[model samples]
Target: MPVSRRDFLKMAGLGLVGSGLPATPLKQIARNVTTDNAASMLYDATKCVGCRACQVACKQRSGLPAEPDAQGLYETPRDLSANTWTMIKLAKENSEISFVKNQCMHCLEPACVSVCPVVALEKLESGPVIYHPERCIGCRYCMAACPFGIPKSQWEENLPLIQKCDFCADRLAKGEAPACGEACPTGALIYGTRGEMLGKAHARLASDKNYIQDVYGESEVGGTSMLYIAGVGFDALGFPRLKDDPLTAITWPYMKAVPAVIAVMASLSTAIYFRTHRDKGKQNGEEASDGSKD
Candidate 1:
């Protein structure tokens, strides 16, 4: 009474059937939210004066603590972190200098939202990619999936949570602008509908001779809620050069195969366990029979 190759195949098939993977492949699932009236932000790099008003406003609105330097004299963070949601980075190319505003791009088809196993990250129809701490399993997949490297984990805590800009979804719901945009004294940061922002970005590109020809986020990674226009090349301003295709194209195939692979492995493991124990039991019975004859 040994298990045959046919029996093994049957077991594998049953495991696949019981895995409960969705009927629709992950690639087929809708990734892009309707963005016609979605909340969006536009940053004009030429207008930014490196005042850091937006950074301060962001911290105040989010109730985040300040990060002090080695001397503990002042809060000057070099990059985004759990406490620092956004920051102004100064990039210098020869004598010319440009202040780059760095934060979550909040892509139309967010890779972070796509990769989260627990649905802890969600892309709202209004354009913010918000995080749900209660639903989070602290997987940190969203941090890795983001092309902009926006999400930061609170590593100090026993149970750390991911943190990043949510485009001020609460403010958007209240029909108010984001704190960062509202705090900009130079009118560098503009908040409006995605359509309106795109229009303004395009208009500036056409009207201003000094501004770069390209709109940074209009088509990058299938577009983003946050857009930028700069006087110098974006590369000089420390912007990542990304393709127009959505990141979901790259992640979906691997995600889709996970369940099937798990099922096959489970079935093989089960079959091995049963076969090993069955052989041991049969050998024990044979020894008992021989003893009776003696």
Candidate 2:
């Protein structure tokens, strides 16, 4: 059966590679202890009203220009873009409505961090996935690797840069919440430690039996700093149904192994060709010597 785009997105969200392999362990390295802690966000779609105030706040905080619509009115973006770091998507199933906020998932084992050939993206000690434009060569590989499609490029600019949510690292350092969380009128977006957020997500799922039993990000892509609680299946909200394993994990081993296999084949081919030519040369030389003697 052909996988639909919606289904593909779900798989992407779950960190499933296109190859359909099971989830694998993400590479994680421990960092030195510091007083500063990792920060995260918890998004409850059931509680979101899609007011888009959070979107406005994000633009204001990030100093991004307003997105104008056909009517020249400021409109919230439907997806994450260079000028829009956060977005809200609406989903409906069986007459039930859900609002899903979209942004960088900030994976515990971030594929972007692992795939960046130039180390443009880094998983910071504070848990936010930060992008260093200075190191970026505009490859946009991070955008391709991200399950959530969170990273954006300034395509219009001559010198493009990858853009995504930083979990408000600057604000967090000053003991401030992310603009989106602070702007959420219904407390739909909450900022805190991953542990605390996971606990809260589980509690919500437990208390609200109707909610999807799965916590979108708990183990997806080896987990994400931003979590979600959805009333409808995540698919309806544009969240891809990903395999438990990250896409990067599923694809990397094959990529790494190909070169070694090619090298071995090349070596064998070279040896065979050389041996054949050497034998022919020896036969020709011996025939010439015999002819000369005769």
Candidate 3:
């Protein structure tokens, strides 16, 4: 689908390429971490200095590889890829500039989880999106279906699989904050229950003029575990103004037609196979008859 210029700006701001939804959105986050609304992270752009410390920490903690912008800057990655699960992006609006941290939105009803044929992606009860590599079939459907285009494939592997931030699932399992959240020196990234994160974000917006009036991830696509507060308007910082509907709702109706198409194609192929064999048999019989006459 051709996206509006505004949506385009949102993707560009994240430094993401060829991914994301049409701005349709998430639902109410779970109140309790173990239930559905588990831990969440709130990113405040006004306090971010673009130090890239969180990015490094995530790489270290998760054992994720780095791209190092091979042909460009020494350490900065152009975007999240198979190697980099988290990234820090910079956007400018005139004299004002903000640094945005980009990762999986971890949607309440994630489209990636919904479309996966093998159930490789799961929305964890503790507020993380977890992936199982063994279940992946290399379909790349998740890559196409993700609203944020967060999932990436490891092209270099003999048997590559999809990859994205799982909000540091292993760390969360041990009751530890995500490595990125812990590494944030300026308190730009804070980790807690989703409710706590939302409350803090709203409180900041209520008390501070430096923050934009809205929390970016609170209502965009049902609701995501990750939330954001920026001094500049979200659009100015390359964030999409998404609706509150889950991205799955926007896709399921069209997806239902796929099975019907496959059935039709299967029937057509069977008819063609029988017809070709019949024609070959008739041709053979005619040649035999001609040989007898000779």
- How high is the CA lDDT of each candidate model? 0.86, 0.79, 0.82
Model 1 per-residue lDDT tens digits across residues 80-195? 99999999999887778899999999898899999999999999988899999999999888888888899999999999999999888898899999999999999999999888
Any runs in candidate 3 off by more than 4 Å, and if so which?
1-37, 69-73, 251-294
TM-score of each: 0.77, 0.77, 0.74
**Per-prediction CA RMSD (Å):** 9.2, 7.3, 9.1
Residue pairs with clashing backbones, model 1: none
lDDT tens readout by residue for model 2, 174-272: 889989999999989998887788789999999989899888887775677888888899888887766555556656765667877689799999999
Decoy 3 TM-score against native: 0.74
Better of 1 and 2 by lDDT: 1
User: Lowest summed-lDDT stretch of 10 residues in model 1?
Assistant: 22-31
Candidate 2, overall lDDT? Answer: 0.79
Clashing pairs in 2: 9-240, 10-240, 10-241, 10-242, 11-240, 11-241, 11-242, 14-242, 23-245
Candidate 3 lDDT tens digits, 39-115: 88999999999998999998898777667666855876788898788889999888888899999988877889998
| Candidate topping TM-score | 2
| Candidate 2: 10-residue stretch with minimal lDDT | 28-37
